[model samples]
Target chain A: MTCTGLSAFPLTPIREDSVDERAFAAQVTRVAAAGVDSIAALGSTGVYPYLSRAERARVARVAVEHAGDVPVIVGVGALRTSHVLGHVDDATDAGASAVLLPAMSYHPLTDDDVVGLVETVAAHSPLPVIVYDNPGTTHVTFTPELYARVARVPGVASIKIPGVPTEPAAAREHVARIRGAVGESVTIGVSGDPFATAGLAAGCDAWYSVIAGTLPEVALRLARPALAGNAAEAEAENVRLAPLWRLFTEMGGSIRVIATIAELLGIAEQPCLPLPIRGLDGEQRRRVAAVLEALQIS
Target chain B: MTCTGLSAFPLTPIREDSVDERAFAAQVTRVAAAGVDSIAALGSTGVYPYLSRAERARVARVAVEHAGDVPVIVGVGALRTSHVLGHVDDATDAGASAVLLPAMSYHPLTDDDVVGLVETVAAHSPLPVIVYDNPGTTHVTFTPELYARVARVPGVASIKIPGVPTEPAAAREHVARIRGAVGESVTIGVSGDPFATAGLAAGCDAWYSVIAGTLPEVALRLARPALAGNAAEAEAENVRLAPLWRLFTEMGGSIRVIATIAELLGIAEQPCLPLPIRGLDGEQRRRVAAVLEALQIS
Candidate 1:
């Protein structure tokens, strides 16, 4: 149950705008079968905010059921404190090993507000908490000082930072600054799939990844070496994924591209993402399909 | 029901983490009694995203009931398209005259996503839609080109643009640009209290005032002249209330400061904001109180 390796975040596939439970179970089972460190369900990659309480609870249950012995971490996000507490309760009742909590701001949360959210959730949920920071989407960035404050809250086990600087030394310094702030207690997990290996080389403990959600082996190629402290090997793996990373950047975000990957590989049904977020199709779908072929990702 | 005068946005007062219906009714009645053109319930100042569907429906009904002859524009924002549709249905059933729809992006929505939201709502709801654009919070800035596209969508009756540029000529030109996009059909309502008079003077059709929600008379002192085409009188009033506007700038946003104004006046109970969004207290509280007195707001 250590938070120190690849934690796969699978797509919570939708069929007709509802959680495709059968497809979701298959997604989880595949990632578990591929031997991930843990299964982090309902992260942004899972489209957490779009799902209803009933849907989220059911998804969490499905994840726990099919994830075998993989420690299941569910993302608990809502605009209101009480509503977030409701999600934490649902995550707990569904038998999750830990809960991933984000500021999830509709209005940008003040530092005091974000800290208060952490304290409230930590106080109520008996499970370990991973503080999620994705400023691009959440619009609430955490200074390392703030991270120091949040990670110290009781039951907080990790900090899932957006991405570290790509340069080797700067990434190390960045991780070091956070290390000095949070010390040895909380794990530092890097998100942002492209920078995953570099962040690991910088001494991050885990990769809370998007790519690992569907294509675990491809992600594991970069992760295993970096987690094993072989920077050159990890960097080589990352260098080879330049094409896939380009696809993510070009598509505006990882969700649509990843969903396209899932659909092309038959991991999930077509139009898996919630409505309003279109999955890539036509020429774009062909482009992703070509990348999958060239990289031999499937 | 033309969207062309001062539209008040009252806070949805919260006590014990539940909607304070009595206080809300009082707030609505006070605005209605002041003869404002419309009462826009559950706009940003209303803490719209924090409330439940049932809470929003009840608040919409209360606003309609207490508004007397005034039109009640209910904000029906939710993350999913279907949930938003459900809110629209509730607003219709509650006898709301129109519904205000913000992209309400938890994930920053694409142009297609936002337009799809408008098209979907327009297809279903009988009431007109106001495209609420507050990019500082919503994080989805609509281009003038995007505005033209959204305006053309059937049932989009208004566009509540954020603050216009400060300089008089610049403000006029900015409003004129939006004017060109939305044209004569869709009303252009201005948000941002500090920018309200300037936007109105610059040819915006309405002033969506947060300050007016707590103190309708004070807002009318400026709105009345501006709506009547007396820009000089409106400018004089805006300059006179410069201190109040400064508080909003210094405090980051209008919600907390306005909530302080409401609570200090006993218009609502203390801790009116939903949990995690702490109301101004102690010295900050005193600053707002002193400003209210200096401006003779109550």
Candidate 2:
């Protein structure tokens, strides 16, 4: 999973206030069937924090059961270190290859706190750990120094850097800075789907993708060219999803848009996201529908 | 509990990765014995997000059992609405007078999401709700318009607005704007200890004090005069502990500084915070200890 390929992140569907395991397994099986390099379950897009430990374990088992040969990376983030260890054990029991640990903050956390979390997980879990640096959600931003610190921990596999700067040189330099700190042993994966091509072109080892989970063929079209040194081709394909990325920015986040896409394309149930997150309004859903129809993505 | 008096929030002490129930009960009892208006358990200071449902329920029960005549307000915030509802039930079962619901986010929440959370809880829970707007922790800033919306809910008792503007005219205007939106029915309690006098002087109905949990006498010295229409007296008391406020800012958050203060006073054990938090380094603890001694706070 920690390689120069696409690791798809699927949104876990919930129905009647419970994990819709049937639809969720279908989503994972579809992504695996579409030939994603890896299936990363319960990422931010999957609403990991909104779920319980037992529900999360069930999702991990379903993902591993359905994702065929694609290695499943489970999100094992919690506010407490003890709870995180418990999740790591559950993920390992469910046969996940790696666990994505976001420095989930209730009180603002220091660099030392984040490092302590990664170290504790590394000490306890048998599976490889991905240091998930998602400042947008977690509030704890990781410096290159922090990344290098965690990368040195035993069983640490990949570092999921939030998005690279859009400019080619700056993105490359940013990636290089992280690379110089973390060295060649640990993989550097790029998230934030809008910058996927730029990050892959700039030497990020993997594209930990959102769109790929729902539309694997489409993400691969944009990602494969960039990973293979044809940045222009990838950039062109990525530009075609301009409406989507624009919608994501206008919508304030990508999860709702991705969920709407899943529902509109008959991939998951309507109102797929859990409670408190009312996926999208009717007008917004109509807009998503129009975009899907216009792009022939359905 | 929603009146113009101090609502003290006590930090839940953790020992060996479990809630030190005896120590926590002692903390609650100390605050109750000191005659605070209400005892708020499992607040940001109480580490509500880090504990499990069972742990939270136990903590809530302990707070109620220890707090004699003082009503206990338990914080029941969770990432999911369903889990929050479950916590609401637990708090009610423990005989909490009200439940504090911060719009805890993993994905950033829109006004609709937050309003929906409040609405759902209001619809189900027997206890009155405190719409907690601590953007410093939860990241969901509640605008005046949003305040008006949630205040319309049936059982909404209070709105814990974060620190008000410091200037006299501006702070009064700020509190007035919220008061106008929420109306006279919802008690406008203020958080952020340093701004206690300003918020109280500006017509905030309550002071949600953090340090009051450990040092009720100290917070009451600052808070009581303001509640009695003597702003200058409250301001003088607040200014006396300027060093304490400065330390809160320097330490990133008040939790660890307060935890260290508790440990130094022999009220709670060392390393009071849950792991991944690492209360304070030895050097930092020494500084906190020095502050307590110089100020005669210990």
Candidate 3:
């Protein structure tokens, strides 16, 4: 089914070096209570790369278990196609509503390759498939032409494009172009913090929020004005949320943001960041705490 | 033991969807026969990523199996550190003299992180460890400072640096600086075609080859002059092998190059590239044939 409005993409918080099922369940309850349209688990904010096959399945199951009636989209991009197909099976088994796949591995891909990937995933997926375009991490941007090609594939239900400012204008242009190309058969969702409002205004069917994990109310409030086409109110809310956004997008990016939020909220005792992520310390932690207090979140 | 003098890095040709073990064996035999000092398996020219864990182990086995008394170093870089460690175990089990570990997966690593990785791998490895730096693929350059840090780590026997023209001046400078920093404790091997001569002349311990897999005799013949300090002769041979270098660097870069050369040499029947690598077709095939014929290997 088409997503009608903004969906809160909560960061999948890890605790004790494993999937924090208790924290995840609580977060989902909060998101549902806030009346967010949907919940996405295992996005980059979830630390998709560090997770193992078993952990990924567990996270998907926890999201679906706590989601109640809300749809859950599970991220299934792996370095190998076999791993991706395996995740599709696991997601289906875990009761995920859909799968969000990124064309991030094995270097840049051609349109034909993207089409092939979509078709392969769709053929095996029990749920609808969502194509994720996050070039910042993947280094491979899915152009409108490629999305149009992927849209034709059966089982593909949505497209999630990151709204980072560093991305070229062509990325946003592709949103409208892809929508027009695919008609209403496919839904469009926006990710990234800075351009969430502009992306919705530019014709994305829904907005995904990273901050929604900790500040569900803030996300809900911002979406109220943004979805209603009230630019002034939405812009003000965005500015208020900007500090948290900056913290999350710092050195560790999404990983740090998600972990810090989990710790502050008492959902997780400590950050379980895998190797490659040096946890926030000293000034960074102080700044994060100050920002959360300023926003009245902690 | 420290590796001194020149070594031939022969490309392992792929034909007909699988590694032509016999052809690879033949190539290895030829490299040994040509009086080459040493040989390596599963370098970029071996299409390491395309092969499954089992397949990679087999490639290492085949190379060592054929090398007899000649020292064989197997490239064992994968996305996961566990996989790298596993390959090191497999290579040693297969009787490889040493293991070449590429910092291919986690790029732009902090100095501490890099040091930790080297220490962990060295601790686990049964054979001597060679740190392979192919920053072109890894997106993380290893500076002299970083190399010095790694060198201090126990069991780091050598470093394999790409001699590619992507950063010719930087490549030369790094070789000089790294040599001065590490001194006799670590050997430095040069990779990439363009700067192989310059690297050797500047005191690189050895020249690693991708074309050697296809033309072992030619690679051995050329290295003799280079190792004898005849830069002019080595440059002429490098020019002759230029076409082969260009072919392998096409499409998927090093991965595609190995598969294509394997097919041309009748070692493997078809290209066994994993997902994301579309096998070479038409123009690429013609180019491979032309290059093989020019090199008098066909």
- True-vs-predicted CA distance for residue A18, candidate 3, Å: 4.9
Predicted candidate 3 versus true structure: per-residue lDDT over B1-298, tens digit per residue? 4565556565555454456678778878877776767787887666575466787888888888888788998888765455677788899899988888776542234566567667878999878888878866655578788888888878888888877343446656767788877778788887775567678767788777665555567766677788898878877887787776676556556555656666667655575555544567779778777877887885
Chain A only TM-scores, each candidate in turn = 0.99, 0.98, 0.90
Badly placed stretches (over 4 Å) of model 3 are A8-34, A164-174, A177-183, B1-63, B74-94, B104-109, B164-171, B180-183, B248-252
- Please, what are the lDDT tens digits per residue for candidate 2 over residues A1-298? 4544899999998888998999899999999999889989999988899898999999999999999999999999999999999999999999998999999998999889888899999999999898899998999988989998999998899999988998999999999999999999999999999988889989999999999988888888887888888988998988888888888888988999999999988888888888888889999999988888877797
- Quality class of the docking in candidate 1, CAPRI style: medium
The best candidate in terms of lDDT = 1
Better candidate by lDDT, 1 or 2: 1
- Better candidate by TM-score, 2 or 3: 2
How do the residues B1-298 of candidate 1 rate in per-residue lDDT, one tens digit apiece?
6877999999999999999999999999999999899999999899998888889999999999999999999998877888899899999999999999988776667898889999999889899999899887778889999999999999999999999997999999999999999999999999999998889988999998998888999999999999999989989999999999999988878988999999999999998999888888689999999988898776
- Give the TM-score of each candidate: 0.99, 0.99, 0.86
What C-alpha RMSD does candidate 1 show over the true interface residues after superposing them?
1.3
Best-performing candidate as measured by DockQ:
2
Candidate 1 structure, TM-score to reference: 0.99
Q: Which ten residues in a row have the lowest lDDT in candidate 1 chain B?
A: B102-111
lDDT of 2 by residue, B117-148 (tens): 99999999888898899998999989999999
